[model samples]
Target: MDERTRADVERAEAALVEHYPHLVRLAHLVLPPSMGRHRKVLTAHGLVQRALPWRAARRAAGALPAQRGPDTAAGYDLVRQRTLELALAYEDRRRPAVLLPTVPFVWGLRLFPRAGGADELALDQALSAVPAAVRAALGLWQLEGLEPEAARAVLARAGVADPDAALRAAGQLDRRTGAGAAALLAAGEFDPCTVHVRPTDLLRRRQRARAAAALAAVLAAGAVVAALPGGQPAARPAPTAAQQALDPGRLLRTPNEEWVRTSRVDFTAWPPRGRQAGDRRLLGRALRVWAAPPPGTRIVAAAGTSTRPPAEPPRLLYAGLIDNVMVVVFHDGERLVRYAEPEGATPTLHFARTDNADLATAGALVIGRGNGWQRYLIAPWVAGVAVRDLLAPDAPPHGLHLAPDGVTDRIPLPPAGGGPCGHWPATELRTSARLESHPAVLVTDLGDLAPVHLAYAAAPAGPAAPGEANGAPALHSWARTACTLRSLRGTGVRSVSNWVYARQPLPEGGGTAEWVCNRAETWRGPGRAMVQFEPPAAGPADPGRIAGRATGTAVCGPYGRGVLGGVRWQAESGTWYLLAAGGGRVDGIDVTGGVRAGADAPTLAVPAARDAPAEVTGRLPDGGTVRALQP
Candidate 1:
């Protein structure tokens, strides 16, 4: 080989050495974190060892004498073999324990193939003969290198003919194995021995092959039966008696069997037809009512209000469970929405509206332990919503929102102060205030507002008007008082505010509830200017007091329709706080409070206040100003 090639191989070897630790770290991250230190170390060592052979082989090839053609080829072959062996070993070691059951099938594929040629038919036969589950796993592993391709190639060499087929099968296997491993890891199972493949154990291999063959035969038979003539195609069996009893469609249907047969109504049909008002009441009574309004069920009119049709029944969209969390989706006709379980001492519903119409704004509501609920109006850009424990009486609540600008807002709702209702102040606010479309609002007491401050209030621009712009028919205040604001030190800011923005149709006809801003801004010091509007004392429903407190500074700025920003504020108490806000008013707060500044303290400079009412500019970490709001 030429000197140039020699140098290239040397550089690659050097890079491999440098990045060895990082590659191992990546592998560990994708694998189980709960792995024993010994296992992790062994895995890391094994991976590096495997990588070293490849690097050395490449280097050796490069150093081969230019005139020695046969010697060079032989050296290259040796390098390739060593690289493949190491990679295969590493891949085998990394196969998640949970996916070990499929190893035999994957191995079997290597031992068996259809027609032995480069023809597509042969490839098809080889793939077809493999068990579907095993095929899927191998395809993911070999082709994808959730396991190394070299390892997959080794695995596939048993039966696969086409190199491409081998690679693909390996990838499929790796993907399945990795996914199962991930699931197992998530469940806290990390013992590699539990899932490891004993390739050297001939007896174990034979046993596994027998079991796999049996399973494959049974599955094949089932498939054949499904394809047989006169056999009815498998259909989604009708809901069981218990399921039918609870199913919305079944419950909402008329009692007549003929009608049920002829109509074949499903849950998709809204506003159950042919039911009397009495029937509606009976159905409502039978259904389990949530503490809060069901998700997606819009508040067409408040509980006690004078509106058209006299009484508008609450409409539910979809209700189900996701990851042990109860989720509901419903509509008031104009909006498609969803809501999930609440976070904190307060039961909360994270909601989202998915539609382009003015009514398509999402929001959230936090129900206090005492059954009091607060609404938070989110931004239009928030596609879906979730709340983790961050800002609560105890645990913190983390919220995630997908902003319109392609950025995801990960907001941690940590307690405002060390304790509930402590002097955690706000350092900023989004200066441009616009109506939010969603049905939730954030409230904090420290900045430019009172204790128990309320932000993102979507009150009717006026008493419910008759046009589309009047906003929803009733002056529905999204649940507020759940979001707590913490203070920023020395900035004189009381608290920062972030919220989602969306426009909803007014209760009347002609206008829209325009979303003004969903942003993150800071307050400078403890002043009345930092106070926010607080709710009543009897807890929301009862009219009481709107009190304010002198917490700290208030920083307020705006994020236009599609922008997101983060702010890190250090308090005089030696605490550090990081706040991030994006287009949908999704705010993430981290209480590094009490963290000390180093000699090279990070600087935060506020931007000059804008003169234009339609524009907003905020300071960034780099001492530069970014225009976050626009007309």
Candidate 2:
């Protein structure tokens, strides 16, 4: 290789190493938790390095390859193509808001997507698109590696008329510099390594430190250029610390003032949660039932009349609360589910889940809620139940009382043989309850109901059963188990799920049970959302126990506004498990003492026994018969 080529390679390597960390940090800021697959970043980085030949450094003492491997060359080409595609797509998406109107620059980008491969003609075209000011800035930063001021001088030679304006536009000025940097990073212009260290996102991160420091130095030295006619300093608002912290790549300050943290736990390292055949059967049944209906549809009602024919008929899945009015969700798993609503006095039908209402044939019945239990035909082939009077927009508040053991309601039905319709009652059954207010009942695996304030709690054994002993105070059983597994098996891991709850009024009027997973942890005084936990302390039995005072806070739920319920962390032999309980309840298997990993997803199981009420007996706020149901 020629000396020039070797020199170029050295420079590129230095740049890559120096800037790789920043690039990763930048990526971390932009992508969400769900998209943080490390392999993807590594692949992109490797591709970029190969595309820029200057970046590749040959081994100092190795023989040159006789010929490039077809596979290796093909891989490099593929990576380059993918990188260019992504960059172009990002540019296209942001083009409308990119203020600068440099068509020539855009044209260059369109022609030579990769910078290293561009020929003289392409470089000239690309350079033409860039304003002289931009060219100078690039030359200083990329070629000469000069400081900002020196770069300004180089830019002046390039015929940049307003050096300050150009720098400001490129995001090198006070306050707005952070915003400009973020924009450039998102545009894939900034070195990614340096950008990702800060918390939050690229959009939210401000170059506050750099901006503030530079501004302070400039002000102290009395460095002043031509001022406006009024001689007043430019009317630029100073950026606040909060604004600087607004990084889109990092966790924002949650309403509860918590920061979201991410950690990975291997699934295989954990002890297996034993699986039962009965559990599998239950899960299969639930999946089958749920899978039967298409999205946008719901099972309304089901019935089995005693006086009906002895033949076993398919169960009804949807119903309404008015005579001849019902809505049914389709069972075909392909089409969106539709809701049928009744019109006014003239028995009309309304079909939901469709954009083209005119295309709908005869409308379905509009099920109107009455003061008492009313009957309506849910669907042509199904039956269901709904609360009456509660359907009104401003109806008086009421609670849904689901019987632990199902109940049946009777309704009058038309004679099967076309005889006169008669007043008959039909029975409908449910196993869950909904409330309008915060109920006094406390549902937890831990049996304590001492009005103790708690920010979060975790139960390794799924939803705690009715008779589990409340562990002793200060004895961190969860932590101890984690330690034991880790000591005995080198690959053990632990996880915890945190739940938050608040003592507040319910939405409607009666009572309500809400759930949420803490995506972030925050600390606010009582009545504000927060997470309270004891830090780890040295101990003989288990040294990893997190020790601190029990605390609680008012927190916002990931979906709706609700108090944080519980947080569960499980440590296994392989990886740690953290389950943040939010809206839905989840189940898991227990393998030996270590909880099974990969059990984060809710497991569909057969419904609990019909006679068994899935209730968590605890203190009731009103001292009344508070009926509890599984969410």
Candidate 3:
């Protein structure tokens, strides 16, 4: 029996249903433009519907994949490959065709996708001029974010005669400089989920309508003469207009005064402040799309957040044009919703749950994100914004400009800890309550929908005493672990605080080193801690390796500061020793396994084997033992 998992009919069905619009779009783009707009639209939808494998077909196919191979057959991927193959076959004149119109064809209606801008038209024309295989490769690259190599592989599996040559041909076309292929594909011209309907042959339709009406009148007159059994309809009152299920006008609006009285400085406190906030039509569209999103709509939701529609009309947090794109934000008590539609591009919406939120977590939101920079919708309380490089602690922060709508300029990001992170960039936001200025906090984007709070605090001083983070010791502590943050990149983190938990003197005349614990709190209600032992490094810029990390344990917080970490060290005299340290929660340290050692105090240093593996634990003042966290 084949051990490799094969695509089953059930999973394929779900994928086809979920991604029907996207699959249809791919088929439509791959099909020839020679088929004309209406024919292509119908045929694309038909091909995608037919891509699903029946149970019998799946059983017959056995262990074989739908063409992209068994190694990577995400149900959607399987159907996608199958759809492309069918489209390619349908376009080929030699093969017998399978015509399917899942949606009944309306003879009097002409359907076409909404037209896009000049760039989209040019892109469509260029794509249409290429071979079907080439168009498929380009669509995969532009829409699916597949690289050329991956696109080539997918094409080869879909039975392309020469994928490399097809890609080369498509590459030769002039995609305007600075115009991204993915962004161009997002234009309205390509989406078939929603189409423009026009009456076909208007003159002929009018003639036919008149004939049908005459026939219907005669039939009704004959029926009335034969029956005479109808009772007088009771005096009826005129019907009132229906309150739309989610009326944009009926949406909950919080009074501006609510912000002043309420302690909650979250989305609920935000008053409608934008030039186009009163635009009913734009708001209605946003609300409608949120309640029942079309299959073509692109949605991004954070981890652990439910995408269920609001039970009641969501509160209008903000409605305005930001950086030329129309954006609308809604607060549904627990979650935050954002809708955006760039000019000439298809609409996209994203949201995240912000339950149990506070001022710091709700400080800034990512209104728009791009390759290297991201624009944030800063909270109203933020009086000033500045950019600071955490690596350069002594350097003054530069001003960050915000638009009238509270959307900021494209703030460039420092390189995520992919390599040697020589510089760490963060935002210093000055937030004030009603009247007085408050100490600023540094925040950074960690691939979350919102920027998370970043700060460093030393244990003896406690978590960054107001203005203390800008001081030398606090900045030094943060600088050591700032680059190490790359490991937590892309997590749905809401806030991260780094603090020195303990200070210990090393053995064999080695200098005193700081034991720090960095804790990160995520929007999903979980926290992670990274413990590091920063020995007397060559320079202040050095970020020491992680000593240990733990989840669900408050190893370095105000409540439970118990943490034990051990590392091998070599003195200037070339003698090796195992150095162990613990925070204030523990009174004793014990090292076991490959190295055997114990200390009466919170610090331990003993001569041991070079490059040894040891288990370290701590004994609290009350005699309770705590195991050390691991790497």
Candidate 4:
């Protein structure tokens, strides 16, 4: 073989056939997940298949990566190099690699790599956090059994700018993970060869097919029309462009009386109410910069939100000086885009999807946040505003000065998260139409388009029932639950609801204690919930610790009418008691493991050894069983 020539065509094909599974697995591991699961699987296969020697160019080779295993043919190395290069290119940010198989789609029934254990999940998540180059290097080193230098050389050949730094980062990841990269990789997590098959939604599949056919017909007609005459398409500004090319005059405007006239009370009905609402220059700059932000501008979109230009001419929500910075909000049916420009500072833009949002979740927007204080652009129907600390239930809510523009004065926010529970303050909005004021609704910011509505369930209400935050018990119930919100910061949460499922009479006359579930729902589909057991205390601030917490669960959501939670409590005499309680839906309770006990009622109290592990199971009225929430 010529030193310059990478590999012979016949030899390369043979080598690829012999090691097809390994190559596909490596490609799958290297490809970024931004393309989504099905696309990633298909793209990985396509990359391997297209890596034939005669068809693909040789990867840059100052020095070839070290060969491992029994077969060390240069043909294997050639295909491997090409596959790595293509896989790196397939990652987000660089360019498209159109090596998709042209034959029948393999994923007509949604195909995905087989699910792995916890270690594999952690490894996959860790890989997702790093650059594609780093992930490639790690995959080569661990899955391919290559030396560190060999992996670095391969990464450099594949056009990774800083291969040495990538190798170093890969090393750091290996150390940080709970298990070794090699051990985790051996779990078949990145194996595209072995996969799980699930059918796509049949109805959605049919709808998509019709939609695609219609789109193709439209495109064909458009092409024919464009070729015949002066049928130039309209020029739309590129969203990520660094220059302000979009005309600001195209921005949409609405009358101030639109709120009263429109039947909708959400963002659509929000009228322009800022002092700078009529400032054409400021509004123009804002719109232009949003379409084409400058180099220094910072852009952030919440999870599950789109990173695209406005689908429609965005209607003005509010435009004014908020906390000394000019802030502008726009709603275009899908999302709420906010643009803020501080004096002598580069502009900052934010986007959050408001899909499926009702008036309760979209009532208020946090326009400005800084210095432990936040300013809100409230709904026009909101006649007055007040601030109250959830932890301080006895304290009266102090009225906040609401400007005619519907922007509230800078109000102090809740205490910072990740600390011991303290004051949890919230904005209280009052509607003007109702003379007998409705129960005060407390809304708190969780870094989204709208503040998350806080719901609480007090006594006399069922486990599934929730009410507004006005009573003393509701405040105390929330105080125990508010500390968990700190974990939800920047998670694009839509709402945080608390429902008291059951009250258990503590063993040895420890008095009545409440069990509540605080669940945080996010716009990104998945949500987390925590069940806490609150002991009877003299004051509202006496917090209860978390009994159980879980992710990807609807333990306290609409569907989960029943919730079971347990706490190992020590009575005044220092005897340990396993106390468990369930909502109304639970007909009986069962205690397993060290403390074996059963209760005909919803509540269970059993004497148990100190620090003994036990599982609490609840039997529902309908004969369905429910386990206690787990971390």
The per-model lDDT (C-alpha) reads 0.30, 0.27, 0.74, 0.76
For model 2, the stretches where C-alpha displacement exceeds 4 angstroms are 1-4, 26-40, 54-631
The better-scoring model by lDDT among 1 and 4 is: 4
User: Which structure among the candidates has the greatest TM-score?
Assistant: 3
TM for every model, in the order presented, reads: 0.21, 0.19, 0.64, 0.60
Minimum summed lDDT over a 10-residue window in model 4 is located at: 239-248
Model 1 backbone overlap count: 147
What ranking emerges by lDDT with the best candidate at the front? 4, 3, 1, 2
How far residue 202's Cα lies from its native spot in candidate 3, in Å, is 39
Per-residue lDDT of 500 in model 1:
25
Error of 1 at 50 (Å): 6.9
- Residue-level lDDT tens digits of model 2 in 1-631: 2223344444444554544443333322222111122222332344344434433445457655334322343333223232333322222333333122122121111111112221322233233233334433443353334577865664454344676676654443212222233333334332333222212222212344576788897785443533435455545677554433222222111121011121211111111111211232322322233323221122332111011111211112233222333332221111122233322111211212211211011012122322223232221111223231201212222333322111123322211222222211212211112212221221111101001111234333222211111223212322222221111111111112333221212222323222322222211112222223222334422322221112232223333222222223222232322322222222221111232222222211121222332222112224322111121
- lDDT, candidate 3, at 170: 64
* Model 3 misplaced regions, further than 4 Å: 1-245, 414-417, 433-437, 461-469, 558-561
Give the per-residue Cα lDDT of candidate 4 at 540: 73
Residue 100 displacement in candidate 2 (angstroms): 30
Off by more than 4 A, model 1: 1-71, 91-166, 169-456, 460-513, 519-631
- TM-score between model 1 and native: 0.21
Model 4 lDDT tens row, 468-502: 76678777777667766777867788878888878
| Structure candidate 4, residue pairs in collision | none
